[model samples]
Target: MECAGYIDGAFVKGEGARFDVLDPSDESVVAQVTGVSAAQADAAIGAARRAFDSGAWSGLTMKARAAAMTRFGEAMRKRADWLSACAVKEAGCPVSSTVMGAQVHAPLRMTDEIVDLFLRLPEQEANPLPMHERVNPHFAVQSLKRWSPLGVVSAISAYNVPFYTAFWKVVPALMAGDTVILRPNPLTPLSSMIFAEAAVEAGLPPGVMNVIVEPGLAGGLAMTTDPRVDMVSFTGSCAVGASVAAQAAPTLKRLVLELGGKSAQIYLPDAVGRAASAALSVCTSHAGQGCVLGTRVFVPQERKAEVLEGMAALLATVRIGPAGDPATQLGPVISAAQRDRCAHFTRAAVEAGGRVVCGGKRPEGLDQGFYWEPTVLDLPDNSNPAAQEEIFGPVVGVIGYRDLDHAVEMANDSRFGLSGWVHGADRVKALEVGLKIRSGAVNVNGAVMSSYASGGGIKMSGLGRERGIDGLREFQMVTTLTIGG
Candidate 1:
C-alpha cells in the first residue's frame, strides 16, 4: 500500500526517497511512505500559516468549530477499524487495547466528550468585584480576560499512541482556533494518515490541518523550526524533547512537551500484596510501552519475598500471543530496535547487581515477530540504572523501601515524574501519600480518582497538561481587555 503526505489541501507524493513500513508482528511489509522534503515540509507550515492568517479556520466561533470537529469525528469513526489494524500491525500490541486507545477512547474524548466542556468556557473572565455597580462612578473601568488562539501549532507526536495524539493535540488545537502542522513518528504513520483522510472527508479547509511524514529525525529539524510556527507540542523522550526545545528556542515558539516517564507504584506495608499485583498488571500491560505504566515498584523491605512470589506467579500465567490475538495478554514490542532496547535495560540491571524474578528472555517458539518475555527485576536501589531510566518496555523493577516516608521518598526520587500510584486504605492515607509524590497524576488503589484529570509531568517528564480544562487552555493565549463604561 502507498502512504501520502497531506499538505495544503490535498494528498501528494513528493520527489523524495521512499521507506518501508513494517508489520512488527511478522516483520512483513505493510505499507511504504515517501520521505517529505525540506521544501515540502515548509510548504505544510506555509499552508497552515495561510489558513491561520486568512482566518479561514480561526475566524469560526467556538460552537461552529465544535460542529466541524463533530463532523470530522463521524468521518473518523468510519475509518476506526483501519486505524486499529494499522496500529496493531505497526505497534505490535494487543488488538483490544489498540481498539480502545485509538478508535474508541481518544475519538470520543476529542469530539463529544470535550464539546460541552469547551462550550462552558466563558467569553469574558473577571476577578469579580462589586465596584462595577457601586457608587455610580462615571468612567468605571473593569479589566476582563479574552482568550485567543496561539496561531500555528507544530505537533511532533510519539509513535506509541499516534491515533490518540491525533485527538489529543489537533482536536483541542482546532477547537481553540489554531491551524496545525502535524509531524508523526516516521516509524508508525499509518493510523494518523488514516485520520488525515477522515479530516479531508469531513471538509476540513485547506491548510487547516496538514500531516507530514518524515524519513528520519533530520526531517524534524525543519518542521520544528519553521519561523511561522507559533507553538511546538511534542511527545517523546526527554533527550529528543531537549533537542526540540533548543530547536524551537531560536523562534521562541511556545512549548508543550509530553515526554517520557519512569513512573512508580508505592506499596505501603499493609498493602504490599495488592499493590504488587496491581503494579505487575500495569507493568505487563501493552508490553509497557505506555509512558505512565508504573515501571518502578516500591515495596516494603519486609514483604519483598511475598510480593515477588505473587508477582512471579501472576506473570507466569500471562498469555503471550500475536498482536491480533484476542486472548493474548501480551504482544510483541514495537520492533526489533525496541526489543533490543528492552534487552539492554534488563542487561544493565543485571550488571548493576540485580536479579530477574521472572521472564528475562524472549519466549521459545515465537520466532517471526519482536516479542520479549515480560521481566521483573529485583534491583539494588532506587537510583540504580534500570530503576531510574525510562526503558519504554515491559520490564518492571522492584525496589525495597522501609516505610511510608521511605516509599514516598523513593517514588519522588526519579528525574522523570509523569505518574505514580499508591495502593493503600481509603482516601485519607493514600491521599497523603499521593500528595507527597511529585508526579502529574497519582492513582489511589484502583479508583483512579485523577484518571481523567489534567496530565503532564514535572522535572524531565514534560511541560504541559493534556486532558481536562487545562488542555483547552494549552492552545490559547490570554488577552486582557479594559473598557470604561
Candidate 2:
C-alpha cells in the first residue's frame, strides 16, 4: 500500500522527506510514507482553523452534526476490512487483534452511541424551576445546563492502536461541533488516513477534518502549541504528555491526555488459577501492547506457587507468528526498538533478582521480525522497575501479596491509576478490594471493557477522561445564562 498525508479532504504527497513502514514479522519495508514538512503541518492546522471559524460544522444544528457523524460511522463500517489490513501490516498487530481494533465494529458503535448522547444533551431542556415558583418560594434551584464545543481540536494519537485511539478523539470532537487536526503515529499512519478518507466521503466539510503523517516531536509540538488549536487531545507516554502539557499551559488550551499505565490484576486465593490464566491471555494479546493490559499481577502469597505455574503454562501456549497468520494469538512487537526495550526490561528484571518463569528469550525459528516470546516475571517487590514502569510489550510481572489489605496496598502503590482487575469466588469481597484500588476503572471477573466507562487515569496517568459522556465533555466548555424576571 502506498500512503501519504491527508489534508483539506484530500490525500496529497508530502514533501520529499519519507520514512519506511517495516513489517515487524519479517523486518521488511511494508510501505513508505512521505514525511510531512512543517509547512504541511501548518497548512493542515490552518485548514482546520478555517473550517472551525467558518462554522461549516459548528454552525450546523445538533441534528445535522449527528447525521453527518452517523454517515461517517457507516462509511467506516463499509471499509472496515481495508482499515484492519492496513493496521495489521503497519503496526505488526495480529490480524485477529487488528480486526477488533481497526475493523470499525467498536468505532461505528461508539459513533452511533455518541450521536445519541449528543442529541440528548441537556441544552434542549427548559429551565427546570419557573421564575414564578422561585419568587414565591424565595428559593432558587440551579438549572442544569450543557457544554458547547471548544473549536478546533488537535488530536495526537499513538501507534499501538492508531485508528482506535484516533477515533476516540476525532469522533467526540466532531460530534461536539468542532473541527480537528489529526496526527497519527508515524508507525501506523495508514489506518488513520483511511479513516480520514471515509470521513470525507461521508460528507464531512472540506477542512473540518485533516490528517498529517510526520514521525517526530516537532510535528506534534507544532500541532499542540498552535494558537489556532482550541484544544489538544493526546494519547502516548507520560513523558511526552508532560511536554505537551507544558507547551499548552501558556495558551491555556483545553487538554486531554490519555497516557501510560502500570495497571494491576489482583487474584484472590480462591481464583488464583482462573485469574492467572486470564492475565496470561491479556498480556499476550496484541503482544501486550495495550495500555490497559494488566502487566502487574498481584496474587496471595500462599497461592503464588500455583498461580505462577498456571501463568507459565498459559504463556507457553500463546501462538506467536506473523500478523497475517489466522491462528496467531501473538505477533511481533511493533518495531526492533520496541523489541529491544522489552528485552532490556526483562534483563533488568532478572538482574534485580526477579525470577523468569517463562519466555525470557526470543522465539526460535522466527529469527527475523521483532518477535519476543511472552514473558512472565516473579518480581521480588513492587519497587522493581519492571513492576513500576510501563513496558509496552509482552512482559508481565507477578507480585505476591500477604493478604487482602496488602494486595490493595500493592495495587495502589504505583503513580499510575489507569485500570485494574479483581478476581475471586466471593464477588462481594472483590468489590471491596475494587473500591479500595485507586484506578480509573476496575474489572470484576473479566467484565468487558466499555469505551464509555473505561477512561484515562488519575495521578501520573494524565488528566481528563475519554469515552462516554465524560469523554465528550472534555472537548467542551460550560456557559451560564441568567434571565431577569
State which candidate has the highest lDDT: 2
Tell me each candidate's TM-score: 0.95, 0.94
Off by over 4 Å in 1: 97-99, 102-104, 128-139, 447-452
Pairs in steric clash, model 2: none
Residue-level lDDT tens digits of model 1 in 1-485:
35457888888785466888887778888777787877888888899999999988898898888888888777877876777786678766688653346434566445766666678888569746588452255667777789888899988888777777656888788888899888888777777676577678778899998988877765578767878899988999999999999999999988899999998888776676585575457644678888888888888888787788888888888888787888887888778988898889899999999998998888888898888887888987887789989888778898888788988888988899988888876568878899898988777775331214588898999898887789778899888887767
